[model samples]
Target: MPVPDPEVRVTAVDPHVSLRTQEGARATPPRLRDVVMAYVGLTKPRIIELLLLTTVPVMFLAQRGVPPLGLVVATVVGGTLSAGSANALNCVYDADIDERMRRTRRRALPRHLVSQRAALVFGLMLGVVSTVMLGLLVNWLSAGLALAANVFYVVGYTMILKRRTTQNIVWGGAAGCFPALIGWTAVTGELAWAPVVLFLVVFFWTPPHFWALAIRYREDYAAAEVPMLPVVAGARTVARQITGYSYVMVATSLLLWPVAGTGWFYPTVAVVLGAAFLVESHLLLRRAAVSDDVVDLKPMRLFHWSNMYLSLLFVGVALDPLLTR
Candidate 1:
């Protein structure tokens, strides 16, 4: 009682603190449901579904309006799986940046809902399963393309280009283009310029499409040090860049008729849709240069419309052979 030694007291407390830390470390692991959700979130399943929508119709065209149902199923499953893999990998790679961006701050990684190692392993497993499924069930060509897309998205876009330039989405978008190609190949067991044209359409569309999101989230992107067009270039310059890409996208969509051998129906819808796209581009450009009016709602409007544009454009492709002269 006269002297409970300070050193002995301190040593006793140290063991308790260490035990507490160990228990916390063990207890902090995520629940199984959270881990499952993290896996789902990585795939960006909704986006993959939309992208795969283009695949079925392209397969129909590749097979001259009747694709094997079995092949179609294989292609869709493989494409969706591979896409989810890429998305998951991106989430894992960008976890730190995701934390800094307000829009992405609540993502699985930033929330500590999933660990990085888990995400990476899950992504790689999805890719391998998808690629193998496509190769054995669909065709080697389709599987090869899927593998290439996964590699490009993970190694090329997420790891390299996303941090390097405003054109990241422009080039990185190639990964998304493979679904059209995969669908076509799954049916025909061969590649053609038609899918390539379809690929270019999505490729060119990505810049303008993504730039709208960038405009809305400019501050977040800048804070996170992501080199999105709006962050790397001033708003005005980014606006001009978006307009230019929109023009290219519109024109590329029209080429589907000539290059992919579609009828006038595709070109006609493309014309009207293309003009609408151009109008949106002009609005984004004008607002960025001359006004700060959220009245422009142009970016948001265009962002929504771009999705419709691609959907309808693909629908037009699907309907062309049946409806056209």
Candidate 2:
């Protein structure tokens, strides 16, 4: 008889689970619900949804309508796996800071729902599987982009820049922008200006979206000693940067109309959504300027609106091709 992999087997009682609580401690058998959710938590599934939103719409625009079913399925699955791997690795790496931050204190690692070693191995497995799936089912270009995104998120953002820079999310957010490029390349098997422009839109949008959250959790980041912009800088400074990035983000979205020769839907959505984004960003800035009211900045108002803006913009991206065709 073949021997099972020792690392993946906990005890003879359960051959499937190797998860342990801590060093030298006996791991009580995890409840079914807890075990399921713990692994699901590793993927950060909500973030994968946000990442996929940018992906599918671009595939529609790239193909000028719905792409092949096989292609769409392959790309989406590959992207999800790749992103999950990156997020899981981030959770493992940031376990310490995560324990200190209010928003992250309940995460799996901080709560000891899973061992750090298990999380590390899970992340590596997903990363490897995702790369192979994309390479085999889609094309190597899409596969390569997916692999690059995972590496950038794990190494560039989580391991390196996250703790060291106030500009962490600004640059590190590039990892999230790869979905657009991946979506485009998945169909056409080549890079082009349209996807590159859409990639920039997401890249610019990330800072403001993230900074609003940073502003809301400035205290948490400070407590954890992570130098997010709002944690290290004055509220006014952070708000100004958010406003600046919002301008570029909106402008980049508008450029997509011209660059892709997209129809009225995209341009109209761009104008309307861009205006709302500016108003909210300016409102946050005004709130920040009130010295006593900085604590009540309510940056989440803009944060939530930014989410809507991206969703609507991408919806228009998908619709433009169908309507124009």
In order of appearance, the predictions have TM-scores of 0.87, 0.91
Instruction: Please list the C-alpha lDDT of all candidates, in the order they appear.
Output: 0.76, 0.83
Q: Candidate 2: which stretches are off by over 4 Å?
A: 1-28, 292-295
Collision pairs in model 2: none
How well does candidate 2 score on lDDT at residue 166?
86
Residues 175-242 of candidate 2 have per-residue lDDT tens digits of: 98899999999999999999999899988998999888777777767877889888878889889999
Winning model by lDDT:
2
Candidate topping TM-score: 2
Worst 10 residues of 2 by lDDT: 1-10
Candidate 1: tens digits of C-alpha lDDT, residues 164-266: 9877878877777788888888888898899988888888888777777777666667877888876767667877887888888888887787787887777
